[model samples]
Target chain A: MEINGKKYKAVVIGGSAGSFSVVSKILSKMSPDFPLPVIVCMHRLKHVRSGLVEGLNLKSKIKVVEPCDKDKIEGNKVYLAPSNYHLFIEFDNTFSLSTESVHNHSRPAIDYTFSSAAYTYRDKVLGIILTGANKDGANGLKDIHDKNGTTIVQDPASCDIDTMTKAALNLFEPDYILTPEKIAEYLNQLAS
Target chain B: MARFISKTVPTLSSFERGLGLGLKDVRELSAFMSDVLGIPYDHMPVSFFKRRLTNVFAKNNIRNVEHFKELLTSGDIKENIYHDFSVSITEMFRDPGFWRYLRSLLQNLSPGKTFTVWFPDASSGEEVFSFLILIAELNMLDRIKVICQHPSSRITEDIRKGILRNKNAEVNANNYIRIEGNGNFKDYYSLQDNIFVLNTYLLQNVETVTGHFLNTAINEPAGLIMFRNKMIYYDKEVSEKGIKTLTGKLSPGGLIAIGGKEKMPESTMSSFKCINEKERVFKKHGFDISWNNGN
Candidate 1:
C-alpha cells in the first residue's frame, strides 16, 4: 500500500484557469485500473456544468463525473467538483456538495475539499496544486502539509496560469514541484 | 539529492487559516444542539457540522464551545441561536434551465385545476420568489397556491415583502435573461430607493407556514415539491426522512424537484421515475411524462 514510501487513502487535485487541458492530459496518462480515487476541484462557470465532465471522460481511461451528494469515493474514477457547489469529503468518505459562501472567490473552493480530505484522511491524503489564477487552494494544501499528508505543486514555470500553484508554494513547502507529465507519472507510480 | 534540493526553495512559508474544529468538539456541539433545539445536527455530515460550528462561533464572537453552550442554555436568544447555525444559500433562477422546465410544466396544467406548490424549506427567499414570478407570468396566480416554510421569520418576512434587493438582483436578472425570459424582467419588480421589490401581485398566493412542516401533513397535497439543495446539509437518515416527507406531501401524480447535485435515497429514487435527470426532477409513479409533452 506504500505509495512514494507511504500509503495514502485519497488523492485530491485542485486547479483553476488553464487547468482543464493539463488535467485531461494527466487523466489520459492514468491506467484504467488506477487504484486510488482521484477527486478534482476545478473552478468552472456555475451554470455550465456539462462540458467539463464530458471532455474529461473522453480523455480519461477511467470515468470522469460530477458526483452527487453522498456518492462513495471509488478508485479508478475521477470526481469533478460540481458547479457552484463546494465539494467536501465528509468524515465517512462520502462526497457532499454545499452552496456555502465563496472562499477566495471560488464556490467549488479547493480549500474546502483539500481541508476536508486532509481532516478525513489525515496523513494518508495526497494533495496536488495545479495551474490556476487564484489563491483558493493554497490554504487547503497547507492543511494537508500540516497533517503530514503528501503535497505537490505543479511547477510554476510550466503552468499556463501560475497564480494558484505559486500561491500554494508560498504558503507551505510541498513534497515536490512537478510538470503535468511528471504529475501523471507520479500518479501512475502511486497506482503501481 | 533531487528530493533534498526541493526543500531549499521555500518562499513565503506563512500558513494562514486552518480547519479548526476537531471531532470531539463537533460531536459535543451536535449533541448540545440536538438536546437544546431538537434538530438533528448529528445527522449532518461531520465536516459540514464542523464548519457550521466554526461559523456559529465566529458569527457570535464566542470565545469557544463553552461560551456558545452558555449562551444557548441561558435561553435569552434561543430562537436566534438556532437560526444562526442553519445554512441556506440560493439564488434566483438557480439552475436557470430548471425554471425553464418548470414554466413548461405549468403550461400544461388543465384549466380550472388548482395546483399547490410546496417549499418544505424555503430557508432563502430567492427560490420562492423565482417560482412566484413564474406562476405570475403564466397568469395562473389565481389557481396556484404556494406553501412556503422557513425556520427564520426574517427570511419569511423578506419573501412576504417581495424584497429582491441585496439578494443579487443583477445576477438574478442575468439568469432570467439566460433563460430567454419574456418581456422585461424589470416589469415584475419596482425600484424604490434603488431597491428592487417584486410586484405585490406575485405575493398574494404565497402562504407562509412555521414549525417543522416536514413532519406535518398538509391538508392539500402539493403538485410540485421543491426540496432543493437543502438536504445536502443533512446525512442519511434525516435526508431520507425528508424525502419521505416530500413524497407524502405530493399529490399522487405530482413531481419532486431536488437540487441538481443531490441524490435521492436508493429506495425512493427507484420508486420515483426521473423526469428530467439533468435538473433532478422526479415524478411519483402515477405521473405521466406524456402529459407535459405539448405534442
Candidate 2:
C-alpha cells in the first residue's frame, strides 16, 4: 500500500468503547519525532478528566496531553480532546472547545472533530475510524473521504467491537482497511 | 500487508440545504435581521446563524423563510427572537487552572489596598459568584470590590438577589472541592424550592448593573477586567472594538482575562503583555507607584 506520495498535514482518529487499548498500542509504536499533529477523539465519562491522558502517555513515545481551549497546534504532539467538550479545528489550525448540547449522545462527538478538520484542512487531513460501539463516526469519515482526504478504518474482524468500523464500511469504501498493528506500521512508514 | 482498496468513489455532497431557504431567501432574511432586528446576521457564522434561524422558525411555527422575515419585521416577535439570540452557558470555576492563576496574581497585590474587579459580561452570575467565593476563601472580601454589568435587567435582578441555577450545584461543588481541596459545597448556598441562593454576606462588596458592556462607559479604572467567552460570538470588527474599549477600562498595571479559547486581536497585542499565554491572561504595562515607593 502506498500513500500516493501525498504529504498530509494532520491525522484525526475517532474511537469509542474498545478504542483506548488500540490507541495506546498505536501510540506506543509511534516515533517520538512524528511530524504531523495527531488528534484523538474518544468517548469517556464527562465527570472524569485525569485517567485517559495519563494512561495513554505512560506507553507512548511521543508526548500525549489533553489540550485546553485555544491551544495552538504543533508538530510531534498527540492531543486528546478533553472530556465533555466538543472540540473543533479552527480555520487557523488551532482548537476551539464548545460546551453546546451533546450530539449523538456524546459531548466530544467524533463527528464534530472530523467534520471541522475536513472543513479546515480539506484534503490535507488523514482521518481514521477505529473501534467503537456506535455509528457516530461513520458520517464524519464519509465527509473526510468526500473532501478528498485520506480515510482508513480498522478491519471489522480485528476490532473488539466491530460496530463502528462496519458502519463506516457500509457508508462508503475507505482508502485503507487494516488491523491495528498494520495501521501503526503504515503510519510509521509515512513518518519514514 | 494492509489491504488497500482501489474503488471509484462516487463524490458525495456534504452540504445540507440550510433551513430549506434559497440563497435569495437567506439574503432577504439576513437583511431583515440586520435592518429591522439590528442583529447583523451577515457577520455571524453561517452554521450558527442557520441553526438559530431554524430554531426560531420551529418555535414560533413560522411556515418558511419569507414568513420568518415577515414576523421579524412586524416588531411583535422581536423580543422573542432577541431572547433566543443570547448564549448563556455559565459554569462555576469554568477553568480551575485559570482561577488558580488569578489567585496567585491577587496574592502579589499590596495587602490592605482596595481594588475593583469588573465583569463586563456577567451572563448568569456563575462566574461572578465564583470570584466572590474565591475572594471569600482568601479572606480578602473586604479588600476587593466587584462590579457586574449585563444587558438583561431580569438576569441582573436575579444576580443581585443572589439566585443561581440549581442544576449547576453538583459541578459547582466538584469545582470547589478541586479548588479548595475540602469543603461542604452547601456552605456557600442555601437551597430553596430547588434553586440555590448564595449567602447574601458574600454579596457585600458586589454591585450589579443592567447595561450592555459596549454601551456602558467605565469612569474608573479596574484592577482586573474579565470578558471571557463572550468575544467568540461577536464579529471580528466588533470583537476588535470591544478589546480596545476593555483595554481602555483597565488600570495601569492591571490585567485582563479572556476565555481560554479566545485570542487577543493582533492590533491590540502591543498594548498588553501576555502573562499566561495558554490561559489568555494579559497585563497592561505601567509602573506601580505604591510598590515602587515601598508602600
Candidate 3:
C-alpha cells in the first residue's frame, strides 16, 4: 500500500472455521522483518468475550491486541475485532466499533471488515477469504474485487471445510487460488 | 432466582402473524398498544394488546388462553383504569451511586449563579423529591428553580401536595437518610392522617409542573437538566433529538445529567465536557451549532 506517496504493504485475511490454524501458519512463515500490518477476522458470537488477541499472541511474532474504538491501524501489528462489536474501517485509517446492531448475527463479521476495507483502501487492499461454513466472505470478496482490489481464496480441496472457500471461489474469481501454505508464501512475497 | 420463569410472555405467533403489518408499523403499534393496555411487558416482543391479555389472565386466574381472549373481546372496559397501568415500579434513587455522584455535582456549583433544573419525564415525584432533597441539603434550592415533567397526573398531584406517604417511602426514606442524614428529612415534612404531607415549604420553594416533554416548550434558561433512564426505549435518532432539545434549553456553562448507560453522540460532545465520565454528568462550556438552530 502506498500511503502519503510512500510505499507500505498490508494484508487482510478473513476466515471462520479453520481460521485459527490458518492465521498461525501464515504468521509463522513471515520473517521477523515483515514490514506491514496483517489484520484478521473470524465470525464471533456476539456476547462471548473475545480471547482472539491473547490466543493469537501466543503463536504469532507480531504483537496482537483487540482493536480499540477508533484506534489507528499501524503496520506490523495485528488488530482483532473485539467480540460483540462490528469493526468498521474509517476513512482515516482507524477502527470504529459499532453497536448499531449486528449483520448476519455475527459481530467482527467478515462482511463488515472486508466491505469497509474495500471502500477505504480500494486497489491497495488485498482481501483473502478462507475456509468457513458460511457464505459471508463471498459477497465481501466480490466487493474487494469490484473496488479493484486483489481477492484471494483457499483452494477448495486444500481447505479443511470447503463451504466458505468454495462460496468465495465460485462466486468471485479470486486473483490467487492456493492452499494456506502457498497463500502464506504469496503474502511473504508481497511483503518483500 | 425464585424460578424466574416469566409467565407473562405473549404468544410468539402474534408477532409472526403481525409481521404482515410491515416491520416499522408492527413495532410502533405494539408499543402504543402495550401502553394503552396495562400489561406487564416481561415478554421479549411485548405488544400492548398482549400485555393487557396477560394481565387479564393473571387477574381472573384464568389459565386458559381461550377464556382470556373472550374477556378481551367482551368490549366491557372502563376509562381511568389505565391511569394505574402507567405506575412505573421504579425504586427511589434506583441507582444510589448515580444520585451520590449527582449530589457531588450539585455541591460543586458556584454560589452566585442561579440554576434552572428540569427533569423531563420525571415519572412520579420520586426523582423530583430526590432532587429537591439534594438541593435543600446543598443549600442551593434558593438559587435553583426546578421544572419537572411526568405522564402521570398522580405524580403532579403528589408534587403539588409536597408529601409522599406511599408504601415505597418507608423503604426509600431509609435509603434517602443514609445519604442525606437522618435528621435532615424531618425538616421537610410531617406525618398527617397517616400520610406524610410534603411540608408546604418545599412545594412553595420549588416549581414543579405537569407536561409531556415532547409537547412542553423548553424556554427555561436551564443550568442543569437531568434526564435519567427515560430515553432507553427511543431510537438512537430520537434520543439524539431529545438530547439536542435539552442541550438547547441549557444555559451556557450548564450541566446535563443523563442515564449512566446513555451517551452523547460523538459529534454532539464537542461543546460539553464530561464532569464524571462514569456517572454521565456532562457540563456545557459553550454553544454548539448542532443544538442551536432547532433541527
Candidate 4:
C-alpha cells in the first residue's frame, strides 16, 4: 500500500459522463479485503436519488453505499457521494456534506472530494480521475500530485468521454493512464 | 425540552482549510461567536464553519483573525456575520420526489380540521412557498396552518417579502412539473428588479417566527416538521441534541422530513420509524391521532 515511501490511506475516484461501467468493472475486480476505503464522487441527476449504489453493489465484491453526513471513513467499503450535496472528507476521517453553490455545475463535484482528500490525507491519498465530460477533477488531481499522492486517470482513448482525462493530462502528468482492467489490477496490487 | 444551544458541542480547532485563519484565531473568534450564534454554531463542523467564516472574512475585508474579531466587537460586521454565517443556500423543491410524496401524504389528511406544518429552519423562502403552493393547490390553504421560523430577522424579512435569487427558476419549474403541478410555475411569482418575488398571496395565514424560538415555545404539536438540509452541518452529538428536541415537539405519529442525503442522528432513531428511505422522512413513534377539523 506504500507509494513513494508513504502508505496510502484511501482511494478517491472521481468520474462523470460515462464512467459507470468502468467503475463497475474496477469494483468487480477489486478484492473484498481491499485495504483502504474507496471514495467515489460522480455527477448525477440531483433529483434522482437512487440507483447508482444499487447497480454498483450488484457486481462489486465490496459493499457500496451512499454515506450519510458525518459517516466515518472506513476501510473495505465504497462510499459514494450522495446526490445534490458536495462531499468533503474531513481531517477527522468523517464525511462532511454541504449544500454550497455548485462548482463545475455539479453537486458531488469530484474536485471537492479530490481536493479535500489531498488536504486531509496529503501524500497518503490515491486519486483517480475517470471518464467525464468536464474538467471537474483536473485541478484536484493536480493538487493530489502536488501533495505527493498517487494520481491515475483512465486512458482518454478508452474513456466514453475523453474530455475529462485529457483535461487532467493538460494540467499535469499523472502517475498512470490505464484501462479499466489495468486500473483494477493496479488497485488490487495497491491493496496488498 | 432539551435544545441544541443547551448541550455541550465539540468546538473545532486547527481550521487548516483554504481560509488562512490560525487555530488560536478560530478559538478566539468562536468564543465571541457563540454568544451571538449560540452553541449550534460552535457545534458546526470545522469545514462548514470555515466556509461560512471565509465568506464573512472576505465580505467584510477582515485583514486578519484579530481584525475580524475587532470588527465583530465594534458591531461593524454584525449584519454580515448574521447574513453569511447562516446557510441561506437552498433550492425551491430541491428534492422533487420528497415534495411529491409529501403532497400525496397531505392529500390523505382530513382537510376537515386544520393541520400544522412547521418549518423549524426555513432559511429560504423557496421551500416555504413550495409547501404553500401544495396546500393551495389541494384547496387546503384555509385548513392547513404554516409556521416558518428563522433566527435572523433579516432573513425572516427577506423570506417574508418573497425575495429569492432568480438562479433556480428553470430547475424549480421542472420540479414543479414533477410534482404534477397543474398551473404554470410562473403564476406563483413575480419578477422584481431581477429578483424572483413569490406572490405574497400564497402566505395567507402563514405565521413567521422572526426570532429564535429557543426550542422552549410550546404550541399545538406539529403534524409535520420540515427540517431538511439544516442538520448536515452539525456533528453527531449536536444533531442528536437537535433531533431529540424536535422529537419532543412532534405530534403523536407526526412526520419529520430531512434531506434525502442526511441521516437521522443515532440517539434519536429509536423514537421514530423511517417511512420513506429515499426521501429521508420519519414518523414519530406514537399512537396515530386524526386532526380535529372543527371551525
| Highest-lDDT candidate | 1
Off by over 4 Å in 2: A1-11, A17-21, A24-39, A43-85, A90-96, A102-107, A118-126, A132-139, A142-151, A160-177, A184-192, B1-63, B77-82, B181-183, B234-237, B287-295
Residue ranges of candidate 3 with Cα displaced over 4 Å:
A1-192, B1-89, B163-166, B180-187, B191-196, B287-295
Which lDDT tens digits does candidate 4 get at residues B167-261? 78888888898888878889988888888888888877688776544443437688888889888977787788878877877887788989877
lDDT of 4: 0.80
**How much is B35 displaced in model 3, in angstroms?**
14
Cα lDDT for residue B31, candidate 3: 53
Please report, in order, the local distance difference test score of every candidate based on alpha carbons. 0.81, 0.77, 0.62, 0.80
Between prediction 1 and prediction 4, the one with superior TM-score is: 1
Candidate that scores best on TM-score: 1
lDDT string, candidate 2, B168-201, tens digits: 6767787777676344668888888989898999
Give a tens-digit lDDT track for model 3, residues B1-295: 0111112322122211222333354455445433544331221122223333344444556556444344444633312223332334233554566677777666555555566788776656666777777777777767778886655566667667765645456556666755654255556667788776766656556665555565574577787787765544343455676777777788777778776445676667876888776567787876421222111
Cα lDDT tens digits for candidate 1, B159-233: 778775455777788988977777688888888888768899888988887545654556778888888898898
Candidate 3 chain B: worst-modelled 10 consecutive residues by lDDT:
B1-10
After superposition, the stretches of candidate 1 with alpha carbons farther than 4 Å from their true spots are B1-19, B164-166, B191-196, B215-217, B287-295
Name the lDDT value of residue A35 in candidate 2: 86
Q: Which ten residues in a row have the lowest lDDT in candidate 3 chain A?
A: A1-10
DockQ of 3: 0.02
Model 2: docking quality category: acceptable
